[model samples]
Each structure stands twice: as C-alpha cells, then as structure tokens.
Target: MQIGNWKSTPELGPLYRQIREMGLERNIAELDAFGFTVLEPGVAAPMEWVRRLRDRLLDVAHERTGVPHDLEGGAHGQLNTQPHFKHQYILYYLLLEDPIFQQAVCNPHLLALQTYMLGFNCRLSSCTSFVKWRDEEGYGPTLGLHADTPVAHPIPVGKDTHTGNSAFLLTDYTLANGALAMVPGSHRHARQPGRGEGVDAAIPIEAPMGSLVVWNGNMWHGAFPRSEEGLRLVLTMYFNRAYLYPQEDYRRNVTQAILDANPKRLAVLLGLADANMWDSADGPDFRGAFDVLRAAQEEAGLPTTANPYEAQPDETDVQVAAG
Candidate 1:
C-alpha cells in the first residue's frame, strides 16, 4: 500500500492548525481535563514514519547495544540471560532528532495535554526508544500497576500539579503483545497498596501502529506480559510542569544545534531553558537544575541526556514532595 503524506493530509490539517495556534500549554491543559486522549492515525504522522523509526531504532540498538535485531522469546526468558537486557534496555537519543519523533514530542495536541496536566512552563522530561521483543519478558516484571508519579517522594510545593507520559506505538499494541494496562482516574488516588485488589481497574490501551496515547502520570498504569510473537515497540516521551526534575539529563543529551534552533518555549521543554524561580526548603532552588543545563548546553556543543531505560539516581531524583 502507498504511504500517504500525513503532514499534508486534510484530515490532519485542522489538528495541525489547532496545535500551532493553541500553544503547547493550552493544548496540554485540554488533554489533562479529559483524563486521556488519542490522536487518530494520519493526524500527526504517517505509518511509514513509524516504520522508518522502528527500523532505525533496531539498527541502533543492535549496533550500539548489541541487542539482536530479531530476538524471539519473552522478556521474561531474556532476563539474566542477555547482559544488555539485564540492565535497563538500550536507548537512542538520535531518535529525537528525527522530524517525525520531534513532531511526535511537540505535537501540539500531545504537548497541550501535557502542559495542562503539568501546568504552564512544562518541558520534555524524557524520551526513550523501546523494543519489547517477542516472548522475551526481561525488563522487570511488567511495570507494576501505579501512577507515573514518584511513589516514594512527596510532591513539591508551588509546582505541585498533574504530570503525564505519552507513548507512540511503532507497532501494533495487541493484548497478546504486552500492551500497557492503565487504571483510568487512578491518578487522583493517593495511596494504592502494592499487589492489592480494587486499587483500580486495569484497561488495556490497544491501538494500531502509529497511534499515540497520552495519560496522566498519576493514573495507575503498567505494561502487561506479552503472550504473542512479534516485537512490541514504542517511543515514549514525557512532559512535566517546570520545577520538576527531568527523567533524563536533557542538558547533556540534546544537540546544541537543536537547542539553538528551538524556540525558547521548546528549549524550555528540552531543559535548555529555565522557568521562573521559586523559593524552596528542598536544598538548592531545585528548579535551577535546568539553568545549569542551559548554561552547559551553551558552553558545550550540545547536551546528551540519558535514555529513560538508563540507570537513574535514586528516588530522590525522581520525587518532588507536595507542600
């Protein structure tokens, strides 16, 4: 089948105009108010774009990380067996360099949703290229059912607001292939017991390839174990209100050229720009981290943020206590 030009398609033109005009903050707010939203296929990107990304990602994963391109088996079976899979899976930042991936991240609809949930002055917290091999369930028991919020840390004062995560499926998200299961509205609940029943109901986010799913970080969600035979791949990106630490060190990962080219608003999302200062008891200004990054990006050629799959600092880095 011929791949249509998604960017030029009439079906997507309206959304494009909406995103261009609404601004990221307003768009994100709209999505947050609604709980979850999905951008229909061909609106943001064409299926071919996803296919190309998946192909490039597989190459990078194998060349840089040495993960087999065609590994068959569950993530569980690969556990402890493959050294690469032992740690968090491999990630490629260059993926974000792709126009398609950039569009996916800056997609006005998705950004608007994230901004609304996270509050104004939000930025991309992290971006990852994930390939869940067939039957090779090795990436830690499908994520436990929980909101994306930092479970251990209290929310930060002044900056306390809703945050969210979005995943762009590069392949079909089938129930048999470990699709993400989420509890709608669970983000509102404060303390959900581990391995308990009735915390919230799990709903599978099944969708065709190229579809995007954005949800509140507070919403309880996790990946289901795969029972089928094909790679379940996705490129996940997160946007959080300013004043929160990014999942990856954006100052170190993104290219300076990209940073120089980005609008100040987009630069802020990349953590190459700073938001207003807020007094806090949490040691340093806490929010100054982005300033540190912005300066570094200016001095250095570019920043190289780590992949989400990479090892993270402890809970302290991920949590923001509520005031």
Candidate 2:
C-alpha cells in the first residue's frame, strides 16, 4: 500500500454515536479484522430478489450490447479489460429503468452498515457491476488497489474507511471462478497500492449466489482470474457521506411515485436532501414528496437534523398534511 495523508477521525456528529449503540460491534469487529465481510446469502438477499436484479441487468446488457447473452455471459459483449476504464459499460448506473434498483439501494442490512461506517447521512455513490465472461477466461485487469477516495473522506485510518461497497454476487464465486481477491486489513495501511502491486497477496473469495460482501472502500483489492467455465457477475452499490459527490445523479432517475410511496431510505440514497429538492408546486393533487419523506425518515430512525428537508411556504401545500 502506498502511504498517504489520512486523518485519524472522520467528520461525524451525534448520529455517529447513536449508530454505535445499535449493537453492531460484532460486524464492526469483522470489518476491522478484515477489510471486508460476507453475509450469508439467505440473510443478505433473498433468492427471489436476486433473480429479479440479475434478470434486469442481463436484459439491459443484452439490449445494449446486441448479444444473445444470459446471466451467465456476465458483460455480454461490452467487457473492458483496461484497468480503471472510465467508460466501462459494466459499471454504468441502472436505477432509471427499474425500481428494483431503488429497493436495492435501501437494502436493510446495507443501510445499517453505512450508517455505522459513514453516518446516517450517507448517500449512494454508484450502483454498478463487475462482470467477467467465460470467453475472456473470466479475468479482467486489476482496477489497482486504492481507497474509494483520495483522503478517505476524512475517516481515520483505523476506525472507519468512510465509503463502502456492498457487492451482491449474481452467480457463484469460487477458487476456480472469477472471484474477488483482497488483502485483509489493507484498509488500515492508509494508502493505495502502487500500479500492479499487491496482487500476489490477494486471496480468492468463494461464495454462492445471492450472497453479499460489504467492504471498506479503502481495501487493497482487485479481481482474480478464473480457471472455471462460467462467468462471474457482481452488482455493487457504493456509498459515502452525503457531502461527498455521488457518482450517479440518482434524484433525476427516481420517479415521483417512488417518492410518494416513500421507501424509508430512498430520499437520502437519491440525494434529495443535498440538492434541497424536497417539494413540488404541482398542488395538492400531485402528491408532494417532503411530507412523505419526513414520515419515512421518522420510521427509519434517521435524525431530523440530518434530513427532514423543509420547503418554503409557497413551494408546497403538503406541509399542512405533514403536520
């Protein structure tokens, strides 16, 4: 790991302490001991939901790549072997086409993990994928080990890494599969891996479909080549503090109906609070989102000071209903 300028504590307030009291000490210990932790498939994601997300991704990938690829094909025909390729279609955002992605961002365990690691004000950075097809030997270049951010979002080197990626495996991961490789406790190194360095120490992760792996964004990690026949598909939803910019402008993709339905974690994940986009002037019939958001926030036990975005008097008629 390349040494860096890392702080000893991240900027988190009262809400941070509250999250500690939520009794996540065991999981926190796992994160401290290892750069990442895996949740058993049944506990993290149900098979029904897993199949839905996998089918959705494959449908979109097939349409765009014009390949007759199923979920097993991984990236269809858009696989990019270049390390850190900014234009990699596999990493593109997918929240707009389906509400399943909206639900995914608010996955219960995922939300709880972020609140403890990044505070309740964390927002979704990117909901993307890492895919490797059998034709390519299920191996892609390492993205180069680096913390999710240059400064680790002001999180201390030992306590928390500020940003996290909760990766859901859409298929099997084994020693022979294109498994993710990681250097345990590398997040505490407070640095980035020099190009092509640290690959030797990485251990292949073996897990089954529907299982999820949550990791500190700073972990020294990358992909390992597969000697197996099938592809490896992983859906990753990355998050960081609300003040940090999100990779995707999620608000634009969230529908008004979704806001009105008020999934407890949606507003924060969608970045509505950061943008001050909490209301509608479309009158009482349009179903404004602010009141709905307040209800959702209260139910989720998120702090009011952190969100509960207010609208100017004329901007909404929903305030009366909210009160």
Candidate 3:
C-alpha cells in the first residue's frame, strides 16, 4: 500500500479531540514531576492496522536481519527458542513507508499528545517494535534496570540534558505479561538506584490496550519478565530535545513524498528540513530541529507533537499457563 493511505479514515476523531483538550505545558510539567504519566483513554487505530504492521515488521526482520518470526507463536517466543535471532532495533520509519503505518504515525491526536508531553519542540529520536513471547522470559534478561539517559555511552557532561524517551504499548500491559516496571519520581534521583527485592517501590503500569505510557529519559525503569504464554507486543518511540542520538537514520529512510506531504514539524522529525537554516554548521542542531518540528505541528492545529503508538485490544488473543 502507498504511504499514508489510511490517514483519511474517521477512526482518529476522538484522539484528535483529546489532543485538543490537553495542554502541552501541563503534560511536560507532569512528566518532569513524576517521571512518567499515562494519558487518559484516547482514540486508537483499528487492530487490523496493527496486525498488518506486525506482519510487515516480521518480513523485514526475516529478510534484512535474519530473524525468523513465527506467525503462530510470536516473534519473541521464536527468538527465545533460538538465541541467534537478529531483529531490527528501530523500524518505524521504514515501517511508515507503508501507508497503514504512516497513518498511525501521523494521527493528529497522538502527535498532539506526544508534542505536548515532550514540550513543543520534540523530535522522534527512535522507533522500535518489541515482541516478547512466553519463551523469552523476564524482560530479555539482558536488559538492566537503567534509564535511557546518561545514555549508555559517554558524552560531554552537560550534553545529557536534552535526551528523553517514550514507549507505546500496542497490547494490554499487565504485570504477568512483562509490562514495564518503573519507580515513580525516580527521574529526580541523583543516581540510578539499585534494583531491590519486592514490589513496594516499583510500579507496574497496568493500562488498557491502546494506552500510551510516556516518561523522561532519566526515569528508572526496566521491562518485566514475560511470564504469560502469549506474545506481549509493544511499539516504543523515543523523542529527544534534538541534541541526542536518533534511533533511526531518518535522513536516508524517509521518502521525498513523505517529506513534501508532511508538515514542516513532521519533516523535521524525519530530518527532511534543517533546523539551523540561519547557522551554517556541519553538525545538525538537535535542539533547533526539535523546535522546528514542534512549531510546525502547532501551526498544523495539533495540540502537541509528541510521538504516540497503538497498544492492544480488549480481549486476550492467547492465554498463559499459571506458574
């Protein structure tokens, strides 16, 4: 299908209304104070769209990364059975080239919510699809309890301030099914806290399918184990102040049509427009890029330009055996 073909549907109305009502400044303040916040129920794209996207992702995984995705068993389970499975880390832009995925990405309500939450000048840093099956067990085991910031690498000290990340659950997020576990307000802590035993301090976000969970990059969080028998799928996208590393090579991946069709804000997120038109610097202005996207989105009548993704449906497709 052509890119952005599904955008004309009426399914996105409620989401747009929600975005219109929410104030951007408030969302950012809440994120700053609590580390994370779950947006109220908003309109979600149809499940068929999500399924199609998943299918396309599996194809990309198999063809480019040699990761086999089992249609019946789910990608995570298949990968766990074979540790050598290689998958794409951030595939949204490529996925968006598909019309269905693009519709979901540009949903005005979701974009508005994302822009508001991240502050007006946010840009898409990374986009990834995570498939955790029953076999994978315990949040990939390798993932540590850490924040996305202070980044996993070394950078100039003050350079850390502009980074942030967000996650969208495309399925119901339950504690037993490897939901994300986080410490509220932990983003304010001076250093990463040790993972302690028990659940008192940890909060597992149990939101309905299609709920969006956004957090600051410094928030102390980690994925929970997938104890359930079915696949726990989620789509995560990170937004930054534009000075941080982007998850995808957006400059190369975006089609010129998308560049032309998209508003100036969306173009910046895709790296189609340069933020520093006035300044002649070899390095891209991460902050300026983010700002341009935010402004363009605002001009387009969106409340916020924050990233948003679909989660799950009301009914469970598969059941997990009790331990």
Please, what is the TM-score per model? Answer: 0.65, 0.75, 0.64
lDDT of 3 by residue, 1-323 (tens): 22221446332343334444554445655676777777544534555665665566567557654767664455532333222333213344443545545555555545665654444445677666666665444534433467676454332333123556655566678887667888787777635555552235677788765666777776778767766665666667677665555666676667768655655656666554444433354654444454555567566654444421113323333222352
How much lDDT does candidate 1 score? 0.58
- What TM-score would candidate 3 get against the native? 0.64
Q: Ten-residue segment with the worst summed lDDT in candidate 3? A: 307-316
Q: Give the TM-score of candidate 2.
A: 0.75
For model 2, how does the per-residue alpha-carbon lDDT over 1-323 read when each residue is reduced to its tens digit? 32222343333333344435554456666877887888777775689999898888777667766775555434355745334432233747776667787777777777777766776657888888765655333334553445675463334645566578888888888866767788888787766777766766778778998988888878888766666554567788999876677888867767778766656667767766453443577433223334444555577754343222344554643344547
Alpha carbon lDDT at 121, candidate 3: 49
After superposition, candidate 2 runs with Cα above 4 Å error: 1-25, 71-75, 79-91, 135-143, 150-158, 275-296, 306-323
Each prediction's whole-model lDDT (CA): 0.58, 0.67, 0.57
- In order of TM-score, best first, we have 2, 1, 3
Q: Which segments of candidate 1 are over 4 A away from where they belong?
A: 1-34, 71-100, 136-143, 151-160, 191-193, 197-200, 261-264, 275-323
For lDDT, the strongest prediction is: 2
Off by over 4 Å in 3: 1-30, 40-97, 117-119, 136-143, 150-161, 194-200, 275-298, 301-323
lDDT of 1 by residue, 1-323 (tens): 33333555433333334455544334344444544566656655677876776776666666664446663443212322233653235364543555556656766556545654564356677777656654445334535576566545343322234467888887778667778777665554544436643324677788888887888766667766666765777788877766677776655556766656544345667654453333455543333555554444344223333322235533235334553
